[model samples]
Target chain A: MGSLQRLGRWTLGVLERLGRGHLFLLRTLLAMGTLVRRPGLLLREIYSVGVLSLLIVAVSGLFVGMVLGYQGYITLVDFGAAEALGTVVALSLVRELGPVVTALLFAGRAGSALTAEIGLMKTTEQLSSMEMMAVDPYKRVIAPRFLAGVISMPLLAAIFSAVGVAGGYFIGVGVLGVDSGAYWSQMQASVDFHEDIMNGVIKSMVFGVVAAWIAVFEGYDATPTSEGVSRATTRTVVHTALAILALDFILTGLMFGDI
Target chain B: MTTRRIEITVGIFVALGLAALFMLAVQVSNLGEYRGGDGYEVHAYFNNIGGLKVRAPVTMAGVRVGRVTAITYDAERYQARVSFTISARYDQLPTDTQASIYTAGLLGEQYIALEPGGEDEVLRDGDVILFTQSALVLEELIGRVLVNLTGN
Candidate 1:
């Protein structure tokens, strides 16, 4: 009976936390209107989130593309369909890997950083001090970061896909000796803008919103201590990764389930 | 100031992102393929379209000369009407061109392959190619093969 009571209490605690997170996201979204008044702050956050994340995103994209090319070439050669390597690589990256992988990297890199930065500010009493000074921290701090994340995600995903395609070309055509013209022509013939690429963009944007929401909410609600900040940052990464994967599945189903 | 430098870098970053998006739209997708002035349309009717889709390439002797623009059901004739536009550079195809839907590679997309016949007249806009071969249904072929195997 005591253990059953403990289980009930644990479930209630999780529900409460989830409710708080939802409220925090709602408030942050409402505060986003103030971002237009301070474009410079938003741009700075974009630099920190988007530009700083570019190196890792690009490098990973290139390597992923190369691996895809090498693997796809080997598999396709067995069936004498080596010419379809480009279509395989391009479709896989643009439709599935590009947005999903970019979002995962963004969660690990930028999301954790945002959580840590905000948690540390909270621990240092900066957020509270700003509130005392008549500055809404939600508007000045969280909104711009969230807006920047949403704007940067699709761009980062696009760059990842582009670099990935180039890397695939380098390995598939240059190394594996697949016909270069066939690679590109087949890809162009198969991939549709509204069907494949735009769906990826929409996916990245959704992941951006969910990831940024989790990061800021965790940081803002963190206990004002060193250990608390670290815990919140870790939670931000874990939660963002899970959310991105789940959202990817749902988005894929909605986008391609019919066809 | 550092602020101006950061802004410039961000601008460049955003510009690069936009360029990548444009490349995806134009090079990867079919956005830049249909500019309207460089092609002329021709029509054909088939008993079955199979997996043929709009934007499927129209090739002549292994060269892409056009693309399928539209597909519609002709209820009156119980056939599928396919419209395609050939580029002006490849506009010299004879009026007797036979349009056959052929699959690219095994388990790949189906495309219209134009086999030009011996004729002096050239196909023009809105002209219909009277001869056409419908796409082969793999399932039907496999079923026929299975029936033959069972009967033997």
Candidate 2:
């Protein structure tokens, strides 16, 4: 009886949390209706979130591409298919790794920061003070950040994929001696813009929304204490990471399963 | 001044991102290759397609000129019929050009390879190449080798 009661309580707690999350998402979306009136706020958030995340995304993308190129060269050489290194590296990065890795990094860097900033504001009574004023904090604060995330994610992913392809070219052609022309031509032949690149963009956009949502929501719901803010920041990273991965699998299956 | 700087920076960022996307679209995909009405289709029949798939490249003399558009099994003839589009730029392929299925690199994907003949006639849309070779089955070759060795 005790165990069963505990299980019931746990289930109720999960459901309550889920309900609150849904409500938060709806309110944020509704607030987005008025975003055009305050473009400056959105732009500022974009600079903070998007520009701030750029260096890490580019560095990681380059290294990841180099590794893929080297590994792909080793494997393809064994089969006398060293020329196909371009297609293998480009397809892997553009379709799967670029968007997913960028999102993961975004979650770690930007998502956690957003959560901490907002949670700190909440703990310090800044958010309540805004409420005491005539300003709607959800409209002024959360919605712009959310919009910035969604807009920035796909762009960041594109940069990552492009840099990654260049990195692959550097290692594959320069280091491994794979024919440079063949590498590019084979890649051009195999990958499709509509099928691979567009799908990856869609995935990053969805990830951006989900990660930003979790970060903002957690901060809003944090208990008014330092420990509470810290916990919310941690939760933002963990939840955003899990959500991005899970969404990637589902989106990949939906986009590429038939082919 | 600060606002202008932020706007300019963000504009540059978005521009760079869009430029990257355009490069991916043009350089990595078929969008740049097959603009509408720029290619012609021809069909070839083979006894087996092996692992041949749609969108596989069709090459002549190690240069890509087309892609396999469709693959269908003809139950009556026990053959696979492949339809492919050759770029309009390469429309001068001789009518007697022979189509053969060849594995690209060892253990790699299969593609249709064309061997041009000396005939002066050029192939047109709906034309069928008469001379063709099917995919070589590795399993069958191994089985035949095993049988020959054991029997001998």
Candidate 3:
């Protein structure tokens, strides 16, 4: 009886989480409603997500590019095609790596905070006060973070991509004795301004919206207690990371027309 | 009063920015000038491109001046024909300039690399580059090297 009841409870838990996800989507749409009426929130989001996160995006991107160069050159050398290393690094970073890695970073750094902040308010009965005061928390809180994450994630992603390319170049041309002039020329030619860059930015924007929505939903719907707030924050970060990765695969297939 | 929210958010952005700066420095320095040098567009024929794709680099004397723009097979020729757009600066190539397929690293992509010829007359645009070396496939090269070493 105990084990059966436990299994039943597990099933219920899965369904509950799914239901919460749907509610989050609904609320996200609701929050986005304020985009036109109050555009200031969008600016705040760009500042918070884009400007603030540039450092991590840059450093991580550089190292990623460097490693790509270091590794790519070696593999190509064995194949007697060492000159193609730049293309490999740039394409991979633009098409997939940059957006996904930045999303994970954003989730770890900001997603949890959003969830906790909202959850804390929920536990403190502050959310109730906001509602009582005729303040739509969705507009005041969720919308800002959602738009900010959307705006900022792409900007940071671009920074990451640019940095990563530089990193690869440093290792390839500086250390590996690759011709600097040619290296740059090849990379420039390979990187299509519209196709590669646009794809990544678009992915980042979508990821931002999804991440912000997940975090906010966790916070706003959190139980009225301290433990609930903590749980909400943790859940938001983990779920956001997972969702970002899943979205990456889907978007890649969609954009590339992959079967 | 400083809110924890503001503090965490600010810290996150600052950290990300620093990383971005480092990455930018690497990319800019590595790529050098993006403009193509004075050179000629050349096509190479191959049985298999072998990991070669569009936008691959084209190198001469170990210096890159162009990239592979397209890869297609001429049914009549029965070989993979790769088109490379080289720069205008690298225009001086003997009619005997050889286009060899090379790679940056093992498991890396294919690139059409050029070797200048001793001839005085330069190859013109849309001219079929005659002296050519096909890509050395990794497996084939290794297999041959090992066989030579083993006297098999």
User: Which stretch of 10 consecutive residues in model 2 chain B shows the poorest summed lDDT?
Assistant: B29-38
In Å, what is the interface RMSD of model 2?
0.8
Off by over 4 Å in 2: B35-38, B94-96, B116-122, B141-152
By DockQ, the best candidate is 2
DockQ, cand. 2: 0.72
DockQ rank order: 2, 1, 3
lDDT (Cα) of model 3: 0.76
Q: Residue A208 CA error for candidate 3 (Å)? A: 1.7
Q: Comparing 1 and 3 by TM-score, which wins?
A: 1
lDDT of 2 by residue, B74-135 (tens): 89888889999999889899989999999987777899999999899999999998889989
Question: How close is every model to the real structure, measured as TM-score?
Answer: 0.88, 0.91, 0.65
For TM-score, candidate 1 versus 2, the one ahead is 2
lDDT (Cα, tens digit) per residue for candidate 3, span A1-259: 9999999999999899889878767776777877888766665665655666666767888899899999999887876666667778888888888889988888887778778877888888877898999998777777777677766776677678877887888899889988776676556556665566667668978987888778778888888788888888888888898898888889988887751
Models sorted by TM-score, best on top: 2, 1, 3
Candidate maximizing TM-score: 2
How well does candidate 3 reproduce the true complex, by DockQ?
A: 0.14
Alpha-carbon shift of residue B25 in model 2 (angstroms): 2.1
